[model samples]
Target: MYRLLIADDEQLEREAIKFIIEESFPGSFTICEAANGLEVVEIALAFKPDLLFLDIKMPGINGLQAAAQINRVLPECRIIIVTAFHYFNYAKEALSLGVVDYITKPAPPEAVVETVKRLIVELESASFKERLAAEREQQLQQITGYFEDDLLVLIAYGEIEAKEIEDYFAILNLQAQTFFAAVATILYPNTPGASILEIEKRVLNKNVVGWVKEYMQKVGRQAYIRSIGAEVFILLLAEENLDEYQARLTGMRLFTELKEALWKEQQIALNIGIGGLCNETGQIGQAFSQAKYALRYEAAPDSIISYGDIERDQQQVFYPYHREKRLYQSILQGDIHASQQLLEDLLTWLREHTSCLEAFQQKVYVGAPRQLTLQIIDCAGSKQMVGPAVDAFAAQNPNIKIDYIIGTSPELPSKIKAQQMAGNVETNVVLTGYDAMGSGLVQQIWERIMPEQKKSFPNLEDNYLPAAKAAFDLFDGYGIVFAWCPGGPMFTYNPDRVKNVPRTTDELLAWCKANPGKFMYPRP
Candidate 1:
C-alpha cells in the first residue's frame, strides 16, 4: 500500500477528496489530512507520502510554497494541485514545480481516479528502476573484489603485460608506480589440536585482515592482502614512487602495532618479513622470494625482519643468451630437430661449467622449448574480420600457433564440451556473441580450466569494447573475448501500406495498437 496526503483549509474539500480516493481505489492507500500549507509540509515530511494533494489557496503558506519545501525534503513524492479557479498562470506555475496533475475544485470522481492510477504506474516504475540500479552496484562490488585477488595472485607468480596493469590501475583508481611485498606468519603452539587451528584461522581472517585493511585505508594507502598459506598472509603495498627507507620503516611500524594488538586482544604472536621495494610489478615474484628467504632467519617472537639485514654473498650464474636466441629462432622456423639439438648442447655446456645441480636445473627449465596454441571458435560469424590479425600474431610468436573454427552459436558449447570429454584439445580461445556467454556455456568450460591459466589473459577492459569486456567477465576470468560485434533486432514495413513508419519499439507498439489487424511478424 502507498501513502497519500490531502491538504486543504476547507474541511469539506478535504473530506471530498478522501472519499473519492477511498471509494475509487479500495485498500490502495493510507490517507492523511492537513488543514493548511504548514501542516501539509509537516505531515508530508513525517509520512513521506507517495502522493500529495494541496489546495492552491491556504491560510499561512500557499500550496506552491508547501510543495517547494516538500520537494526539497522528499523529492520522490508526487504532488497534485487543487484549486477553485482554473487560472492559466496557476497551472503554468504548478507545472513548473513538477506537479503530476492540476485539478480544479469540484473535480469529477473519474478525473481524480484516472490521475491517481497514472501516478501509481509512474511510481512503481521508478521504484523498480531504483532497486535494479542498487542490485547492479552490489554485483559490481563483488566482481571488483574477485578481480583484485586474481590480479595480485598473477603478479606474484606469473607474467602479466604492463598494459594490463596500467588498465587495472586506471579502473581501480590506484596510483601504483612502485610496490613492496610483505609476509606475516602467525606463531601458534607446536602440534596444536584441530580445534585450536580452526579457531586461530577464524580469528586471523576476521580480525587481522579487517584491522589491516581499515588501518591502510585510514592512512590513505592502497594495499592488497590475501592469505597465501595456512598460517601466512601476504600484503602488497602500492604507492607512487615510494621511498625505500621510509617504506621499510613503515612496514616495521605496522607489524609492531599489529603484533601488540594481537597479543593484547587474542594472546597471539606474529612474525613479519619485509622485502626490498621494486619499481616494476613484473618483479613481484622476486620480491616474494626475497621475503620468504628473510622469514627463514631466527628472529625474536613478535619481531620484524628485513631482507637487507640478513644478506648473502652468492656466486654469480652465467646465462647462454646467444645460444638460447638461436634455439628460439630455430623453433620459430619449424626446425624441431635443430632446436632440440641446440637445447641438448646448451644443457651439456651448463652441466660442465656450473658446479651446482640446482643452478643447472634452473637454466634448463628456463631455456626449455615452450609452445602455446590458441584455438579460436567464432560464433559471431565475423571470422574474416579478425582471422588475419590472429595469423599475424602466430607469425610473430613463431612458437605459438593459432587455429580458427567457425560454427553457429547454438552448436558451439556442446562441441567444445564433447571435445573435452574425448580427451582432445578444444578451443582455448572463443569469439562468440554476448548471448552465448550469458547462457552459461562459458562458465561450464571455466570450471574445467586451471586457475593459473585463467589469470594468464590480459586485462579485458583494455583489450575489448566495454560491453564485450563485461560479457567476458561473466566467466570471471575463465575465458578471453578477443572480438565482438553487436547484433540487434531488425524490423521491416511496407512503405506503400504504412505512413510515417515508427523507428523505435515504443512507437511501433503504439502504432500496432491503433491498427491491430494490419500488423504481423514472422514466426521464429
Candidate 2:
C-alpha cells in the first residue's frame, strides 16, 4: 500500500487534498498531513510516506524548501506539487526535482487522481529495489558468517570488495580449522556484461549458496566459496575420501541450479579439481600443489575431472618432469615431422583423458597449438621452463565450446585492494588436472574431512595453525583468487570492526576513509 503526506500551510487546502486523494485512490493509500517544513520533516521521519502532496507556499518554510529538505531524508518519497501558480518556472522546477506532477491549486479531481496514480507506479518500483537491496545486504551478512566459521572452507577473489569484508569479519570472528584446499573454476563464455560480482551476488541469493551449505551440513562436510575471478576460484575445505566424491557431485548440482537461476542467456560451466587429501591439518601446503597440479587437465575429454581421477600408469622416468626435456627438444629441434607425429599422439591422449599441466606441457612442447603453446615459447625465451610456463595462464585453458583459451583471472580495482575475503565458510571446491602434490600447504589440507559442526566448535589450535597459514599464502589470507570470485569484496582488519579483515592495500584505505577517526595501529 502507498502512504502519502500532504504538507500545506493552509489547513483547508491540506484537508481538501487529503479528501480528494482518499476519494480518488480509495483504499490504495494512507494519508498523512503536515502544516510546515519542520512538521513535514517530522512526519516524513515518523510516517515514512511513499509520496508527498506539497504546496508551493507554506508557513515557516516554503514548499520548495520543505521538499528539498525532505528529499534528503526521504529520497524515496515522490513529490507532487500543489501550487497557486501554473508558471513555467514552477513546472520546470518540479520537473527538475523529479516531482510527479505540478498541478495548480483547485486542481480538478481527475487531474489530482491521475498525478497520484502515476506516482504510485514509480513508488512501487523504488520500493521493490529497496527491498532487494536490503535482502542482498542481509544475505551477504549471512555468507560472511558462514565463511568465518572455523569448520567451513572458503575461497574468494574480488567480488565483495574490501570494506564490507572487514565489516563482515569484525562481525564473524575467524575460527581456525584444519581442512583440505581445492579450487573450482567457473567459466563464463562470451558473457559481455556479466560480472563475477553479479554472479556472486546472484548465487548468494536465496537458494544457491544456502542449498549448498545445507547439503554440506546435512552430510557432514565443510567448505566455503566466493566468486574469485571472472570465473575461477581456489576453495579450501576438509574432506574424507568417500565424502569428497559426494560433496563434489552435490556441489556440481548446486552449480547447475545457480546458473539456471542467476544466469540468463549466459552459459556457466565449471572445471573443478580435487587436491589429494592431506593426512594432517598442519600440511595444507601439500594441497596447493595438488590443487595447482590438478589445473593441468583443461584438455581432458570430459569437463569435470579430479587429480586422483586419472591414470598415471603409462610413462617411465617421470614423463611430466624428466621427459619434458625430450618433449622440448622434440619441438625446438624443429623436427616438423617428429613434432607433428608426437602432437597427433598427444591429441589422441587428450581425447582419451582430461589434460593435466605437466603432461599437457610435455605433449604441447612436442608441438601442439593449444593457446598456451605460444606462451610456452615466450616463457622459454626468458625464464624458467621447468613447471608449466605461461603468461596469463588462464588464457591457455581454452573452453572448447568457445574455442578460446582464456581462463578467468581477477584483477581488483585500486579502491578495493585492501578488503579481505569471506574467510571461513565451508566452500565446495572441485579442481581438475595439476597433481605434483607439493609442500605442507596442500599436504595437510585435503587430508582431513570436517564433521558437521555448524552448531559445534572444535578446539585444535595446533592443527589449524597451518591451514590458516596456507589460506593466506593462496590469496593473502583473504581467500584463493579463482576466476568468477567477485573482485571488490576483500577483507580488511580493523580492531573496532572485528568482523572484517582487509586483504589488500586499497581496501584498508577505503575502510579508514569510511570510518572517519578509526586508527589502525599497524598502518600508523
Candidate 3:
C-alpha cells in the first residue's frame, strides 16, 4: 500500500485530505497524519511514506523548513504544497526541494489523491527493466542491495515488519474464505539509455494491464500486483469460488491483450511465464519462483507454458545431466562459433529430451549436477570506449539493478609508484541500488584498480578480462568462464563455499591441503 504523511495544523484539513486519498485510491494505500511539522517529520521518517502533504502556513517551523529538513533526511519522500494563497516563490523553492507539485489551499481531495498516485507510478517507473553496465563484481553488489532493500525487504521477507503483511492476512481471515496467487514473469531486452520508467509507464497503460486490473476490481476479492524479477506479478485470492476455467480464460485474454499491446503499441517483445494457482501466500513465493524457473526455458514453440505441462514432461526426460556437461566442455574449449550455431539445435534437443516445462525450468533436480556454457563473440572491432558507451546507456536504463558501475576505460593515464598493476583490467569498481546515476561505478574501477597485472607470460590476452556479467540466462547464477580461458573445461566451478577467502596462495593451498582437493585456483 502507498504510504502518505499529512502535516496540517488544521485537523479538519488533514482529515479532508485523508478522506480524499481514501476515496481516490480505494484500498491501495495506508495513510498516517500529523497536526504539526515536527510530527510530520517523525511520521514520514518512521513510516517511510512515499508521499508527503504539507501546509505552508503552519504555526511552528513552517512548511518550507519542515520540507527542507525532511527532504534532507528522505530524498525519496516527495512533498506536495497546500497553501492558502498563490505563493509563486514558495512553489519554486518547493520544487527545488523536489516537491512534486504545488496546489492552492482547500485543494480538492481528487487533486491531492491524483498527485500521490502519480508519484507511486514514478517510483515504479525508475525500476522496471534497466541494466547495469558495470563489471561483474559491481553488478553482483548492485543485485544484492536491490534484493536486500527494494525487492525482498519491502515484501516483508524474513524479519522485516510490514503493516501491509499483517493487514494482508487479517483481512482474509476476517473477511474472505480462500486465497490464490498466480505469478507472471516478463522478459525484456536490456540496453543502455533506455528509460525503464518511461517504458514501464507505457507498458502499464497497455490494455493488458487494464485486463488484469479489472479482473481484480470485483468486490469481495483481493489482488496484489508488483514487479518481480523481470515482470509484473499478481497475487489473487477469491473469497468464495475457484473458477479455474474462468481464471484460465482470464489469463488467456490478458496474455492475448498483453502480447498485442506490447507488440503493436509498445513496439517490444515480451515473453510471459504463467504459473499454476496456489492457495496460500507462503506457497505463492514458491509458485512465483517456479514460474521464474519456467521462464528460463524460453522460446517454447507455443505460448502459455504452465506448471501442468511441466509435470507431464518430467516422466520421460532424455539428454540427462551427463550429456549437458559435454556441451559445456565444448564451449570452454573456445568453440563459441559452434555453440552459437547449435543454439536452436540445443534447445530443440532439450525440448525433445525433456517431458515438461518443469524439468526445463528446473535444470537439475535432486543430486543431478548443474550444467552451463559460455559463448563470447568479438564486438566486431568497435571503436575505443565501447564499454563506457554501454555504461552511458546503462546510466539511463530504467530496469538496471546497479546504478554505479564503472564504465570508462581500464587504462589509467598515470600510474602511482606503489601500485603494482596499471593499464590492466581495472579492479572492480562498485555501485548500489541507492544511486540514481550509477552507471560509471564499474568502468572507473576496471581502468584504475585493474584486475590484471603485467604478466611475463606469452599469452597476455588470456589474463585480461574485457567484461564479465553474472548471466541469469546461465545455470543457478554460476560464473561463466570467460571466452579467453580456452581450455577443456568451460566452467571453473563457482566455489560452493565462500565462508573463507584466503588472502595468500600459500594459505589457500594449505587450506586446500587441509581439506584435500577442495579448491581450484585460476590457471594462466
Candidate 4:
C-alpha cells in the first residue's frame, strides 16, 4: 500500500479528491490531509507519502514552495498540483519544481482516478525492479560464498596453482595479500563400552565445522574453513603479513578460545596446529604442510602447537585426505576433467605408496553411489496438487529422490525436448497440463503405461472419475489422467449494473454495445 497526502486550505477540495480516490482504488493507499502550506510540508516530511496533491493558491508559502522543500528531502515523492487557474506561468513553475502533473480545480472524478492509477502502475514497476535487484545481489553473494569454499579447499589440498589463486582472489574480490593456515583434528575419546565408530559419529556428525565457522565470524576474524574427514583446515586471511610473534599470539588466542568453547559447550575435543604466516598465495601449500606437521605432535588436546615451535627435521607421513575431498567436490560439481585429473593423481599416489592389489580394489569401487538426485520438470502452480502424490511415491520408494523444475505448460515440453536433443535427459518425470501432455504425445516424448504395469494398480480405473476416464481415453494409451476437474464458461456480474445476465457470446457482445464501457473479462 502507498501513502498519499492531499493538501488544500479548502476542506471540500481535499474531501472530494480523497473520496474520488477511495471509491476508485480502495485499499491501495493510506491517506493524510493538510489544511495549509505549512501543514503540507510538515505532514509530507513526517508521513513520507509516495504521492502528494498540493493546491497552488494556499495561505502562507504557497504549494510550489512547499513542493520545492519536500522534493529536496523526498526526491522520490511524486507531486501533483491542484489549482483553480490554468495560467501558463503556474504550469511552467510547477513543472520546474518537479510536479508530475497539475489538476485543475473542480477536476472530473475520472481524471483524478486515472492519474492515481497511472502513478500506482509506475510505483509498482519501480518496486518490482528494486526487489529483482535485491534478489540478484543475494544470489551473487551465495555464489561468492561457494567460490570462497572451493578456494579454501584448493589451498588446503595443495593442488591450486599461483595463477589459480590470483583468479580466485579476483573473482571473490578479496583484498587479502597474505594468510595464516591452521589444522584442527577432532580427537574422539577412548570409551570403555562404546565403539570407535559410535564415538566418531557422535562427535563428527555434529555440525562442528559450521560451529567453528560461526565462532570465527563472531570473533571478528575473516576465516574460511573446510572439513576433510576428521580434520578441518582453516585459512585466516590478512591484508598484510604478520610477524612470527604476532602470528603465534593471534593463533594461540583464537585456537585456545575455540578449544575451550567446543569442549565446554558440546563435549567435543580439538587438537589444533597453527602454521607460520604465508606471505604469498604460492606458499599456502607449504603452510598447509607445516600445520599438518605441527598437528602430528603428541601435544595436549587443548594446547595449540605452532610450527615455529616445532622441530623442522622430523617428516610427517603423507595423507590423501585433501586429495580425496577435492576429488569428491569435483565429482559433485560435474567437473569431469578435474575429476579425471584428480583420479589420476590418486592412482599415482596409490602406485607409489600401496600395493597393486590394493590400488585395483580401490579403483573398482570408484563409481559407487554416494548421493543421487532425480529431476522432475513440472508445470507452474501444480505443486499443491502433485506434491502429496509425489511425497507418497517417495515414501514407498524410499531410494528414489526427487527435485522439481517449475515451467509453463508450453515451456515444459520445449525444455524436455531440448534436453533430449542435447543427449542429456535431465527430466525423469513431467507433471504438466493436458495441453503439454497432448503435445508430448505428438512429439513421441511420452511412453504408454504397459498392460503389465497396470496389474500393480488394479483399482486405478475404478477410482478415477468419469472426467478423468474420458481424459485418459483421449490420450490413446500414451498417458494417464493423474488429475481432472469439470468446469465450463462462467460469468460474474454486478446485479445493479448488469440487470440482464448474458448467457451467450452474442448476447454478451450485444450488451457491451448497448452499454459502452460496462463489460469486463479476463484475458486467456
TM-score leader: 1
What tens-digit string does per-residue lDDT give for candidate 4 at 107-181? 567778889988787777848456544644665676577677667666665666777888888877776766788
Winner on TM-score (1 vs 4):
1
TM-score of each: 0.40, 0.25, 0.29, 0.38
Kindly report which residue pairs in candidate 4 clash with one another.
none
Return the top candidate by lDDT: 4
Q: In angstroms, give how far residue 100 of model 1 lies from its true place.
A: 30
Candidate 1 residue 496 C-alpha distance from true site, Å: 60
Kindly list the per-residue Cα lDDT of model 2 for residues 23-47, writing each as its tens digit: 6777988888898878987888889
Off by over 4 Å in 1: 1-125, 128-132, 159-161, 189-203, 236-240, 298-301, 314-524
Error of 4 at 390 (Å): 37
lDDT of 3 by residue, 385-486 (tens): 345654565567534433222322112211211021111222222221111111122112212211222342334335545432222122121222233222
Model 2 misplacement above 4 A: 1-178, 187-211, 231-269, 309-524
Alpha-carbon shift of residue 462 in model 2 (angstroms) = 53
Model 1 clashes, total count? 0
For every candidate, C-alpha RMSD to the true structure in Å: 19.8, 25.1, 23.7, 17.5
In model 3, state the lDDT of residue 462.
53
Model 3 TM-score is 0.29
